[model samples]
Target: MNGIILASILLRIAGVGYSLVLLKRSGDRRFGFFTVLLTFMAARQVLTVAGTTGTGLEELPGLVVSGLAILTIHYLDRYVDEEHRIKRELKDTNEELTIFKKAVEHAGHGIFVTDPDGTITYANPAIESVTGYEPDEVVGENPRLWKSGEHDQSFYEEMWATICDGDVWDGEIINENASGEFRWVDTTIAPVTDGGEIEHFVAVDTDVTDRKERQLRIEDQNERLGRLNRMNELLRDVNRRVVTTTKRETLEETVSERFVSDPWVVSTAVVDRTASGRLRTRYVTGDETAIDAILEDTEEAISTLTAAVDHGRTMVSEQVKALSNDDITGDTVGVVPLSYRDRNYGALVVVTESSKLFEIIDHELRTELGDTIGSAINAAERRRELVDDRVTELTFAIEDADAPPFELAAATESDVHLTRTTTDGDGQRIVFLKVDDVDAETAMTAAASISNFSDPTLVSAADGACLLRFVASDTLADTLACHGATLEALHVESDTGDGEIIIDTPVGNDVLPVVEALSSRFDSCELVGRQEREPTIDTAEGFRGELQADLTDRQLEALRTAHLAGYFEWPREHSGEDVAAMMGVCQSTYMQHLRAAERKLTTNLFGDERTSDRRPAVA
Candidate 1:
């Protein structure tokens, strides 16, 4: 064992000596010195172990030193690896920072960095595009130099207030460039903090002047289109009302009401250019106080109307002031002539207090309106003459068998309240009325109530309801009538039942008259339906044919049977079963057939859509 241990020690000493020599040759002085120390220690260990070099206690310190040397070398190797790793990580961090700087520099939107004092520290090329000031010039300068003066100082205070609070500030702002032209930008500014204190600010902005201008133009166009659409709707209403009425007063009233309803119009007044060459107020509505003064101002209203009548065209008065009425304000006005076939009926004047330009309200629309009114007036006059030539003074009373509506019953119960009705070419009259619910005392006074309206022949009346027929100025039982129109319907229901009249004006007459008269009477009137039907030669056979045409063979048979059985009489002379037996059919079947026939006939005759109010379905 001793010889083996001695050989091991000798081999270690020789190895240490060779290592020192190798290290010295390599010019590594530190490692060479370490190798020499190790060689001397190894020699000492060999002698001490053999008890020929030193005592065990004396060699203890050398062993301790050797162990510490090994530990230091291992730690030094780990430290070298850690340093390499740090270098690699730092290289990666530097590369990432370079990429971030390049990205900001090439960004399309303006980018700028500022110190805590708001002094520009860095600016990208995009900022140059925005302010027309290069980075070299903008650096160290406050962004206030590019202020357009568009915003007040308070706006800047708010911006700083937001950014300084560490909250991001984002919104649109206007600025001036080097050329002194205003530029709009959408911007965002954010604060960078160090140790919970704001250190700097980074601002990003995009140019949006072009986009903003485009948006404004689009809004303007939409406004113009909206105005045109509204005007078209108003004109359509006028045209529709002129469908069944041709009364001059009616036309004027309709025109006035529609014009006033428009948002652009402050007031409307219809003035007539009478045959005596005098201006007379016809119909006026909306802000009447404002219009009355303007109308009384002879120079403003009369002069404008005269010009319109003389030129036979619409006249526009801009910024017209009424000197006659001191309290009245000035506004833009339009006067259109109502002329037909070389005859002038009147002039319609509309005033607008709108500050917006009136160019959008086309002149052509006003002219069309004037022509329509003139035509209606002319038609009314023509129909009157025709009615006078055809029918003598007479009245056709409603029969008890033909039931009138509740409103009609109330009107019939009052002597002052007369049920005025007119019929379509098919000899059908539908009258809607709001009357005092009295017990059957009103008179059939269509002829007396209206100079031109046809008298209705009462078909049957029962249970406070009656069905009457009035066909164009030739009463159902001998009456007179004329031209007509349809109205933009209005309905109001209150303590008084609604009186809605579905009048059939004479062929070619505007329906405006019926709507106007009914509205004046009931405070609310609505048109049921209107057709552009021409007046046909009055004949009972034509009316009968119209009803028969809509009925099936079975329906006609049932209707004929029911009439013969006196089923149309008040209190129904016979039961439905008896009538059905007379027709050799089940009672239900007969009633169904009868109701179908009645529905078709009433719908065609009165333009009444109700299936509940059976109009005694008899021919």
Candidate 2:
């Protein structure tokens, strides 16, 4: 019995090993079968061995029963271990799935999933809030249902092209919701890919309608403001040009031409202040009849404008009832003060039918225009004064009066006393004479004693002085001859020194020979001066003294000789032929020199040719 038990144990172990191999291959719970086989093998072996090498049927039954019982216990233990491991794995997988689902559903931006044909497959709750559509309603519907059609076809074309290329499309879009209300959205659509091929599209969007509208309004306002600024700049440029011109006609024309299309300017006028302190219209644009009537009643206009000025304000009136009997319709008038140096000069009246036209006429523009008009008026007045002064001086010089009297006294008592007198006829004839230095009676006796003094008559006599007037032929030559006599007889009791004198005379061709003779005689002792006086325009080319009158060649030559012989010099100096050549002429041929020399001499002796009439030639 002990040997049988040992063999049965060995058979049970072998059977369990074979059954374990079978269960491992079958992938089923075969461990129980393996244990039973092991028990049967052990029992069989024991029975055989116990029967002394003979088979035993009763031993086989006992061996099989013991093997089956052991196999069942082993197989059951293996199955229990596998079941516990599978349960643990299943629990972990469920936890991970729950986390993923929560993440997808709770995203902030409204997320949408669409099929390749743009059909909405899924949408988050955020989509309902943004588009006013429930997730169920949007799903399976074309995403284009939300399109506002505000975006052009090209816009959608580009969007679809980008997505089909597996690229993300990001931009602004206008969309319509379930309520048919339009809205702007900032959207991003990206293609979902499966194995590198686009499968569907996912779009995330946010509402941006309010921000977009605000930006557009701001842009429009900026554009309008920019246009207004440009208009103001143009107006300023026009104002600058208007203020710079002084001519009345030019000013009016410029203003009318420039502002012809301007709604504020119905007409333009330049009002000049008269000597009587009343304003008169000098130039005007538009209907002459109206302008004439307005100018005729300037006092009333002035009174109205003055009231406006007194308040230092612009006057706006809808009707001319205050100045005219007629009711002027369809007109608005703005009267602005024109001032210079803070003093009122005149007024500018602008007329328009539109009240808004005056909106641009602010204080700054009014003040600037006022200043410009003032400056132009002042400049015009100065030019007038200058012109008048010139005319006065010319009148005096041409008349050949005794050049008023020399205000400065002579430096010496011995200086020759020069007296001037005019002839009775026409009074164009002028003569200078010398009288003996003696008491009046003695001078008269001496003058009566001179037989050469023709028609000698006493013009004036006083205090040892006597003035004798006589008609002399060739008065200029006679004057020079008398000066020579005075110079030669200086030691004589009644001598007046070498009578080196210049004569103011009319120029003519016959005067040349007489001038040459005088020049030869008075080569050292005295000098002769010749001058021609005539009326001429006070201009650069027409200005001259001796040559003032139309000159003859001979007369011009005579004048030239006189100029070169120290006649026109400052201290009465001389430079004969050499000076004449330097003046671009031969000594005898002095007409050309006379013209140029006279121009220079007159400019120096008088003033510039432009203002030459204002000054007289030095004695």
Candidate 3:
């Protein structure tokens, strides 16, 4: 029995210790009840082993203590459970707070936290890098240090109000950094509230300065490209007219008209220097009177005009409103020089009142415009020279004096080309005749109808013309010495007999006796033109009467038409196709007429034997 009691006591003690350790480790209320049960068994086992019997007072005290101990165990277990729950919740909260702090510190965007009064409390490393300020410099300072003047006071007030109202604010802001340079940012501000009142503000900002700058640059470049394209279009439209015009008057008129028609220009004029060095107004359009008014009022305008021709450079003059009238007030006049191949012709003056419009006419653009006009002038001048160099003046009429019938032959002067020269063959005199503008059929008809020559040997009859080799005896020179006409001097000949002849005469020589002698051979004769021109210089007066011609009526008309229509220079300054179009003829036909007139002119000047005597032909 003693051994049993001792073993029971020891077992009970071990169970109580184990239960206490479980309660401490697991914080389980059930483990505390097991500890209390073990304690009561240990107490009862000790009392029974001591041979103690259950008495009234002693047992009652033990029972009360036991009851108190049981109650203490139950409440102690619940207390431990509640304490463990609180510790777990606190640990989780602390872990979450640590994660949030690290996130804020490492963020790429600038993060700043401010107190309720807008004083900066914390600035992340990113905020310091973006604002050019260290954390120490920004903390405790107001965000006003970063404000840029781009936004008004009202903007900041509204932003602050939104944040203070426990709301989030998002916007773009231009701020100045520590370097005194402005930066753009996309920013969001959130108010952090505690105790039902706004306590702090948190801001996240992303640097967007580079993006904004790129956008602005792209817009500017696009605008400039559009402007350049428009200018090129205008230049192309003007150049088309410049290339086709072969006359100075036409070119000037076109330029002035086009310029005036543009919304920019008010008036325009072309001032050319005459060969004598005098300024002449060649062409004008769109309030042309303004040019005259300017010339009369401002001596400087005349100087500028002279400078344009003498220096062959562009010049500009401005007439303020005080010096100008309603017709042309506050005009910015640009005198563009007309020069080509280092030759100066004159100035093309353009005027406008708007300064902005004048800005569009840059130096390079003005030069190109001048070059277009200059090229046209150069082409026109060359054509004029070609026409003027061939001028011929003479008169000739012929009829048979033998009372024999002469056929009044007729042919287009333009359709016939004749060339004659005197040559020697085998110690004998021969006249070479090359008749052109004839096809095989025309050659046959001409050969059948003409009895003027003997022994005509056909040389070559091809390409709508004929080359004939003629065999003439020495009697050719003596056969018609009285006729006094050389092969090369036969000019403007027509079957209807309306043509002219050249006579090389000194100033005092009387041509009446020789004319009378020639008239005796023909039934009648009359002089239609005469000219004793001296050598000419490059002047207006020198070039006058440039078309002094003794051409047949048909030949004269052809030459005149060629000159007026610029057929001489039409179709891009060299091709006369346009002249053919205007004259209602094929290009070949028109060329035929023009070449015939030119041939007749060349012959009359140097081939006519009458002119070799140097005597004037008089009626």
Candidate 4:
């Protein structure tokens, strides 16, 4: 028994020491809990050792204390494992946040987070780079601060509507930078959602100002091209009509209409040099009063245009105010020389609102229009020249004294009823006699035969009442002597005279003086006809006859028959075949007779003056 008590006491002491050591090694909280559990277990174990000699109740206490100690150790281990797991999860979450933040800060695109109301929640550094604004300055501000006002308020309203509806919106936006400059941006706005509810808005933007500007420029160029095409078509139509028409009035009207109808043309006018070399307005569009003002101030305009045309250069006035016209107000005036084949004909003055607008008119278009107007003017002038030529030719044909004879035989064969005669027997004649009444035929024949003659031939009609002057030819001296005879006696006179005499004759307002002067000198001489001299044909004088022809029955019969025939009409009123048939002969035979008759009559009437002996031949 003594040995058992001693061993138990020693074991109790060792257990206490071990329990103290364990409490110290475990931390303070675990230490207090372990001390209590170990003390209970030690007391139970001591009791069990002492009860071994007595009841089993002592073993039960020891068992309960040991079970409590095991439960405390297990709980402490679980607490420590739970704390370690929480720490590891916290570390992983922090690392993920660091990576996300790094990505957001360094992103290339401008990222902005805003409330559903468009208030900026967060702006990345890219926002400052793109907008020239500090992130802090823009944060918490409504995105509308960047609105350029170029787009209407409805644009922003639509954007908000899309974002609030949880839909992504993408479009271009014109926005103002912090520098107060406008910038175009391509933006995408997406709604941020939490549990099916919109929580915020996110916008991704790209600076697209350069691209937008380029697009606008392209559109402008296309519009200009369209305008150029229309101008080309208009020019072509004008060319076809204006260049071909000879009427000056038509061309002027067309130009006026075109100028008034064109939206781009501010004003237009045609200026021409007058006889005095001063520029005169011929046609104008815009305001007539303004046109008058321009004309009044045209000394300088004329000077400028003359310089341009003389130099064959284009003159562009920096502004219309620089032009001489005080009434004209515009930014630019274009003076284009109108020319054909390098010859300057005129100048076209075009006024415009802008210099750039004038520049837009293609060089080829101006050149073509200038040439067209010049050519039209040239054509019109040429037509006038032709008409003048025709008139000149007709006057000369009527007035020439030594004109080719009217073929009486051909006239007779053609059944013409006009009597043809000459002064005396000289065919150098001004007037061809045609008797309207047979009662006057005798007096007319007698007046023509005795009038003035170097060579004379008389043909009496088949009836006893009339006679015809068949042929007459006289020299220039003889003709002039006859003219002096009529001039010496004041009387109504008509006679074929020398070329020099006809040239010396007076005309126009001077003619009546000549007639009066001659009437005071000659008795039977009266001024009966006036002669017209023209460049293209021969010249002659007209005369009044007071004497008639005396001839045999057969000669007078032939003369009357010839006078009844159509011969003197231009392009012949009767055909040669018909004339030959009327003459009772073959066409060829009758033509030969007609030629013979013409030679005989011309030679007898003109005599020595019929050919080169009379006057020098003219071209």
Which candidate comes out best when scored by TM-score?
A: 1
Q: Against the true structure, what is each candidate's TM-score?
A: 0.48, 0.32, 0.41, 0.40
Candidate with more favorable, higher lDDT: 2 or 3: 3
Predictions: Cα RMSD each: 23.8, 24.2, 22.7, 19.0
Candidate 1 to truth, TM: 0.48
Off by over 4 Å in 4: 1-121, 132-183, 187-204, 286-311, 322-331, 341-344, 353-357, 390-619
Each model's lDDT comes to 0.63, 0.54, 0.63, 0.53
Query: Residue-wise lDDT of candidate 2 within 1-619, one digit each (tens)?
Result: 4544554566566656666665665445556555565656665565556566434444656556656656654566566556656766777777777775565567666788998889999898788767889888899998788888888999989989999999999998889988999988889999999999888898998888889999888987785576457547646765776667755446556654564346445555555454233546656665334445455655555555555443345566654443343533225556666655534545666555454455555657666666676566555545554443321110001111111111001111122334443455754444334343444455445444443335556655554445556554433333433222111111111222223333332221122223333444343322223334442335555445434454555546657567557666777665556555655667766645466656555554433323234423221
Candidate 2: TM-score? 0.32
How close to the true structure is residue 154 of candidate 3, measured as C-alpha lDDT? 93
lDDT value, candidate 3, whole model: 0.63
The reply for model 1, stretches above 4 Å from the true place, is 1-53, 56-83, 149-161, 210-219, 271-281, 289-335, 341-347, 351-357, 381-619
| Superposed Cα deviation of residue 323, candidate 2 (Å) | 42
Rank by TM-score, descending? 1, 3, 4, 2
Please report how far candidate 1 places residue 266 from its true position, in Å.
3.7
Model 2: weakest 10-residue lDDT segment is 392-401
Residue-level lDDT of model 4, residues 1-619, one tens digit each, is: 2444444444444544554655565444664666565666567556656656744443554445455555555565566557557878888888888887788788876788988677898998888766778779889998877888999878888987887888899999888999999998889999989998888988988888888999989988987887777666667777777866776656766765675455666677666564234566667776455345444655544455665555556666653334434555544566667666644555666665566555666566676677778678656645654554421110101122222122221222111112332243333552322222233444443444343432323343333223233334432323333222111111011232211112132121113223333333333233333444443333332100100122333333333334456554576666777666766767787666666555444544432122213322210
Per-residue lDDT of model 3, residues 294-318, tens digit only: 5665777777776775677777777
Candidate 3 segments whose C-alpha is farther than 4 A from its true place = 1-83, 150-158, 161-167, 194-196, 208-223, 226-363, 369-619
Better-scoring candidate (lDDT), 1 or 2 = 1
